[model samples]
Target: MTTQPPPRASRPALAPRRAVGSRRALASRPALLALVVLLAAGLFGTAPASASGPASAASAPARAAASDVVAQAPGPLVWADEFNGPAGTLPDPARWNQEVNGSGGGNNELQYYTGSTDNAALDGSGNLVITARQGNPRGYQCWYGTCQYTSARMTTAQSFTQAYGRFEARIKLPRGRGMWPAFWMLGNNLGQVGWPASGEIDIMENVGHEPGRVHGSLHGPGYSGGSAVTGSYTLPNGQAFADGFHTFAVDWTPTSITWLVDGVAYQTRTPADTRGNPWVFDHPFFLILNLAVGGNWPGPPDGGTAFPQSMVVDYVRVHAPGSSGGATGAVTGLNGVCLDVAAAQNANGTPIQVYGCNGTAAQVWTVAADGTLRALGKCMDVANNSTADGAPIHLWDCNGYLSQQWRFTAGRDLVNVAADKCLDIPSANTAPGTRLQIWTCTGAAHQKWSPPAG
Candidate 1:
């Protein structure tokens, strides 16, 4: 396979986003496949908004069915990839970034993951191949045995990030004991706080033994593995996901994340899921592709398992809420204003840092007239009615909280009813070195903020 040059990075253009439009028809419910170890933590609401309305609604739209009737939905390609060509070449670094470490090897899985070329390669014949080979010293040791395996983990971590949208991958799995393959996403802010806090979305995960079933899950502090908010599905009679390529996906919005396989809905969740820990899925998360050998979920490779197995990926595509060419945006708290760190990638519990308005896209944000603060396609809200000078602005599981509520008055000033204050970065200093802090309602220059025009 030939290595392709990463696409030239450029400032994305600002274009109109195509709305999902009126209600979506529900798809027949698929059986839950992922095991959800829902923590004893309190139960939260479904989603923030009606699938047909603003981001602050009380309930999310029901899962859509392929044949179910729907409103006039505008359809044009948002993003897609068709795996084609030879093997041994690397994926476009611009489009796909590999994770270098195991990050404590989440899932307790045994495979050592190197975002390296050896484990992940493109086969010349229309597929991105990920191979799990045994007896590699640089690989991880299994929790079940002495088996050593090398695998690849690829993601769009540093390059492209998406918020509310549809994410899908076409692929076939390798059948054998202890093999784990997944197409998932993690909040881009993970480096700041860490797992369960940054949030995780697993669109599909399959083990060797579960040939006919695929799993979908959402992980956060309060709800995660052993305590994860998960579900699964089994294909129609005698059909195995490992038998061939099938579309696995999730429709994400500011309010909820919906799971599907071959157009069948399995489970859905909203921000309120974070009532105790807050469902942290409502933000910019990068996509991940990996093939692991053994872990907590799939168990370990036994005597019957095979080595040198391969997971084939046909392609991956990301679809956002708006029209093509439109820029999707998010406001990351870098300045001291939010107590968020500089390039730290904050997760669920990271302290909100305060910094100056460097006018960085990470800090630039827009709020729709409908009250949805559309940054990375997720809503940004004040945490717990905090009007204190050090109030923390967090990305909560979108529950129509008055605390999550805000209004952009006269098109610029961000006024918060819960806090009775406007979004103002203290000590209005635009220098890259200044810290952005929040203060009481002063209606002064420090409180004035003009969002960059799209």
Candidate 2:
């Protein structure tokens, strides 16, 4: 969870136990409010007037169509929070741990986060409402002095963590200057590795000053704070995201992380995008949701600002690997030859090769949701985790290693995640026992493959 900046400055290092300060600037309050009012009235079609209202029925079809276009993860639902409890109830204690603090979020923020239902609670209508209200009634002392605002920040750190898959949430953001709402994630090893080093994935963050835009960012060792790798999506026609609900999601794979809003992909980051810095995202991470008031990036609320602003959430969901859309059959390459394990071997380091398709057990391959290609109870792996051309492909025990990950590109190339290379048939050889290797992706016939029909 972090703040938005005018020049993409450093964001708050948001975690349950710690806060790190950073500065950022945004548009003047009056101009932003005017823009938001105009956009909300003109661009929001059939959307609810307020976050507390029920979802519009007329928008269901469009949402479903948009979902159909999204490249959904081939997995089953592993975790979710629908917030269907009685009104005024807290979030499920089993899944969320609400943080209580007056630490200012390290961004010079004004809100003192609390575990009270007044700050965060479930509506009878299936939504998690995180409200930012004026006046801290608890007499909480903040970093600077007495707290002037109160809000809620919740996390799934103690309940769940996953390495790779789909993480998403549907949220209706709050508006007014100084309101900052976010749905994000942090590495589960945060206690050990600490901020930035533990990695931060800001799936969606919207500052009140920019009601029409939301940002997605990645923070790591060298590219953290104001220097984080980030991108923003602006609603067309000056539409304010606060006018309705939008789904924010990230498809995290072994090699890439793709950001999507309302089912449309806008940006994708790969290991290569790190600028030679270590990619620290290949590990388990937990989720966080918060609505902050008056931070460094958004400044403080002005005269036009309203009280009891709520960031309403419809749901938060996670999908596990290999729960859907996988095939188990012949994985054919050039000349329709099947990818096979030598001698039907199940031992580690057994060569993976090309052989005439004979419907044999050795030819059977399963495209796994975690990006690994499996056969004979083993994954197709790079020999010695090598990136050099002609590094042999072999069978190894199924492990969540970058060397074992593969992505079937639109161009039909089977690329390795760790090596950033292609699975190749050396010399374009058609021999039945030709061993496969990792080579620079060349878009050649020898590097093409057709995975089994799903």
Going through the candidates in order, what is the number of backbone clashes in each?
Answer: 62, 3
Across 1-454, the per-residue lDDT of candidate 2 in tens digits comes to 3533222112222453222223232332223334444554457654333221223543211111111112233356789998999999999999999888787765777889888999999989999999999997679998889999999999888889998888889899999988889899988777776676888898988888889988888888787767777777676668898898888888788877877666445567888878899999999999999998887677899998989899999999887653223677887899989999999988888899999989889988887766678888888878765557988999987655556767654346677755557899999997989999999877699998876765
lDDT tens per residue, model 1, 116-157: 667888887878989888776654444445546678887777
Candidate whose lDDT is highest: 2
In TM-score terms, candidate 1 sits at 0.54
Model 2 spans > 4 angstroms off:
1-72, 322-453
Reference-based lDDT, each prediction: 0.55, 0.75
lDDT of 1: 0.55
In the predicted model 2, the residue pairs found to clash are 9-226, 10-225, 10-226
Rate residue 342 of model 1 by lDDT: 44
